[model samples]
Target chain A: MDDAPAYSPTPRTRATRNRDRVRYDAATVHAILDEGRLCHLGFVADGAPVVLPTLYARVGGVLYLHGSTGAAAMRAARDGGLEVCATVTLTDGLVLARSGMHHSVNYRSVVVRGTARRVSDEAEQRSALDAIVDAVVPGRSADCRPADAKELAQTAVLRLELREVSAKVRTGGVNEEPEDLDLPHWAGVVPVTETIGAPEPDAAMAPGTPLPGYLRTFTGASD
Target chain B: MDDAPAYSPTPRTRATRNRDRVRYDAATVHAILDEGRLCHLGFVADGAPVVLPTLYARVGGVLYLHGSTGAAAMRAARDGGLEVCATVTLTDGLVLARSGMHHSVNYRSVVVRGTARRVSDEAEQRSALDAIVDAVVPGRSADCRPADAKELAQTAVLRLELREVSAKVRTGGVNEEPEDLDLPHWAGVVPVTETIGAPEPDAAMAPGTPLPGYLRTFTGASD
Candidate 1:
C-alpha cells in the first residue's frame, strides 16, 4: 500500500453538516468515485451555476472527462484550465426515521474541486479514453476498436487532478430521538441497489458472436 | 388535463449539444424528477461552483429541498433567494460502439435553473417535510411519525419554482460509423438498472413489526 498522506480538503469540499461523516483519506474518496458511473459536473457559465451529468473515470490521482469538441462546456474547458466541481454520489438506502426531520438516505459521495485542462497528448488521451471504457465495463477496451485519428480529433478529453477532495458517507440504520422510540410507526432501512441487467445484442451482430465473459459476469458497485 | 403550456427553457437550461434531446414539456420534466431519489444541486459560493447531493421533492410546479438549519448552503439559500441549478440523472446502459468516440451511456436527465427561497410558513413547511420523506419511499410519510415543532424549526427548506426546466433523453442502440460495422469486435448495450433489496429490520425494532407494502414492492425508474 502506498503510504501517501490524505488529501487536504479546501473550504469548498469540506462538509458543513454532519461533520463527522467527512473523510479526507484517499482510499475512501477513490472508492466512492470508482463505484459511481455518473457524475454531476458543476461549472459557472455566464456568471450562473450550471450542472450537467457526464461520464467520467479516474486514473491514479487524476480524473478524466470527455465530450464532443463542439460542446460549449467542453470548449470552455479545452480553451484553458476551467475551474469546476465534480461530484459522484451513490445512495445505498432510504433511512426511515421515527420522525420526518431525521429521515435521510444512506449514501457515499465524493466531491472534488479543481481545474480541468484539455489533454493534448495523443497517447495519453487514447489511454484515458480506454480507461473510461474499462471503468464502465472492465476488460471492454480489448474487445473494441480504437478511435481513428479523425474521431480522436473530434473528441475532447479534460483532465482534473484530485488534489482537493472529500468523501462524506452515511450508512446503517436510522437515527431516531430517544423520546420517539415508542412511536407506533415501523422504522428501518429500505436498501437501494444498482444491478446490471442482461446484455442486449445489436440487430446487425454476427449470428454466433458469443457474449464475452466480462459482460456475462457483470456486477455493479460491488465489483 | 390542465392544458397549460410547457416550460420555456431559458438560456441556462437549454442543451448546448444534441439540441434534439431537450424537452420543454412539464410532464416529462416532472416524471424524471419524481422518479429520481436524489439530485445534484449546483449553486455558486464565493464565485465558485459547488455541487452536492440532496433529497428533493416536487409539488405542482415547485421543488422543495431541505437540510440542517446550520448547513452553509442551506443558510445561504434561506438568507436570500439564491440562484441554483438542480440536475437529476438516471443512467440506463453502457452503449458499446464499434469506435471509441461513439460509445455513450443511455440516460434520461433533467436540469432545472431557478432561484430558491426559504419556506417559512408553518403549514407549508410541515407538508414539504412530509413530501420529502415520501419522495424517498412513496407512502412513507403516512406510515412514519410526523415532524414535531422543534424538529421543524431546526430544519431549513428551500423552494425552487420549475419555470425553467428541460429533460434530455438518449435511448436505443449505439450510433456507429457505417465503415466500422464490419469490425471484428463485439458491440452492443449492457443494460443497467436500479432496484431495492430485501429490507433489513433495525436492531431495536419491535419483534413483530412487519415490512410495509411499499418497502417490499419497491421498484426503480423503469417501473
Candidate 2:
C-alpha cells in the first residue's frame, strides 16, 4: 500500500458530531474501503433517496462500482453521469457501557460523495472490472477466464474519484459515565470478526482442478 | 418472534431486475434487519445524496435510528420528517466463478425506503432507546442504568415504519456459463461468517464487576 495521498474534507464531507473520530487520511479510507466486499450506494431517484448494496473497489484515488446494465441504479447513473454517495462500512465490535445512552458500535466507514461517471472506454472498463474482482479475492481474477467483448458490453461500471471523502472510525474502550461505572453491568466490547470458511467447489468442477494458491490462505483481509 | 405484517411492493419498491431473488414476505425482511446492528441511512442533503452508517433497532414494523441531536442526518429528519432509505446488508460469501464477469458476493440486504420522523413522545422514545441497546446485546438494556431525562434530551431517534420495504437475497451457487465449465479454474464459494470474540473488559472496569449472564454465549446474532 503505497502511501495514498490524503484528502482534505469538503464542506459537505465535514462530520458534525464526534469530530475526534473522523479521519481524512487516505490510508484509513482505503484500508476500510478495501476490506469490505460490498458498499451501500446511495443515489437520488425520482426526487427520493435510494440506497442499494453493491460490490465496489478502490484503485489508488478512484472507486469503481459494479452492477448490471439493466439494474435501476445503473440506468439512473447513465447518460451524463449520476451524483452518488458510495459508503463502505466494516463493523468491528459492540460497545457495551454502564449507561444505556452510551452504547454504540465500533466501526470503520468511508463515504465517497461525488458524481459517478459511467465508464465507456473499453480498456478502462476492463481494468476496473479486474480491480472489482481482485479486490474481493486478491489473485483470483487472473485464474478466472477473462471477460469477453460480449460480457464487457453487458456490465455497467461507474468510476468515482475519491476527493470529497472522509472515514469515521470508532475504536476504543467504553465511555462509561463516572456515576454509572459502579453499576452491575458489563462495560466492555464484544469483538466482531469476518472469517472465511473452507472453499466448497462447484459440483460441475473437474475433480482434477487444483485449488488455487490464493484460496488456500485467504483470510479475507487485504494484505 | 411473531410474524410481522407483510408489505405490498409499491412502484418504487418493486425491483426491476432479478425479480426472482426478491421476496415480499415479512419474515425475510425482519430476519435480515434484526440480524444487522448498523444500517446505512441515506438522505438527500442540499439536493445531493448522503449515506451514513448508524446504529438502529427494529421494534416490530418500525425501525428506530440512534444518533446525537446535533448530527447532520438527525437534524435533517427533525421537522415533518426526512425522506430516507435505510439499508442493512449482511455478506454471506465470496462467489468464485469461471468467468471474471460472473464473480459476485452472496448477500442478504433489506432496503426500507420511507420518511423518517423524529420521535417526540417520551414513552415511545424511551422504549425505542431500550430496544436499540438490547438489540446489540439481548437483555443488555435492563441491566444498565436507564436513560434519564437529560440524557434522553441529548439523544435523537428517528422512527421509520417498515411499509415500503423489500429484501434481496442471493444464496444459491455460482451462475457459471455452460461454455466456461470446461475452464480449468475452481468455481465455488468461500463462505464468510461474522463471529464474536471474547469480551474485553474496559481498563477502568471494577475488579469485582462480574461478567453479565447475557454475554456468556453471545454469538452476536439476534436472539
Model 1: CA > 4 A from native: A1-3, A68-70, A219-223, B1-5, B68-70, B219-223
lDDT of 1 by residue, B34-150 (tens): 899788989888788888887899888889987542366677777877888889999888998877778889999988888888898999998998898888888888887787787
For residue A102, what is the lDDT in candidate 2?
87
Indicate the worst ten consecutive residues by lDDT in candidate 1 chain B. B214-223
Distance from true location, Cα of A30 in model 1, Å: 0.9
What interface RMSD does every candidate have? 1.5, 1.3
Q: How well does candidate 1 score on lDDT at residue B200?
A: 67
Among all windows of 10 consecutive residues in model 1 chain A, the one with the lowest summed lDDT is A214-223
Worst 10 residues of 2 chain A by lDDT: A214-223
lDDT to native, each model: 0.82, 0.85
Question: Candidate 2 on A119-205: residue-level lDDT in tens?
Answer: 889999999999999889998878899999999988889999988999989998789778887776768888998888878889898
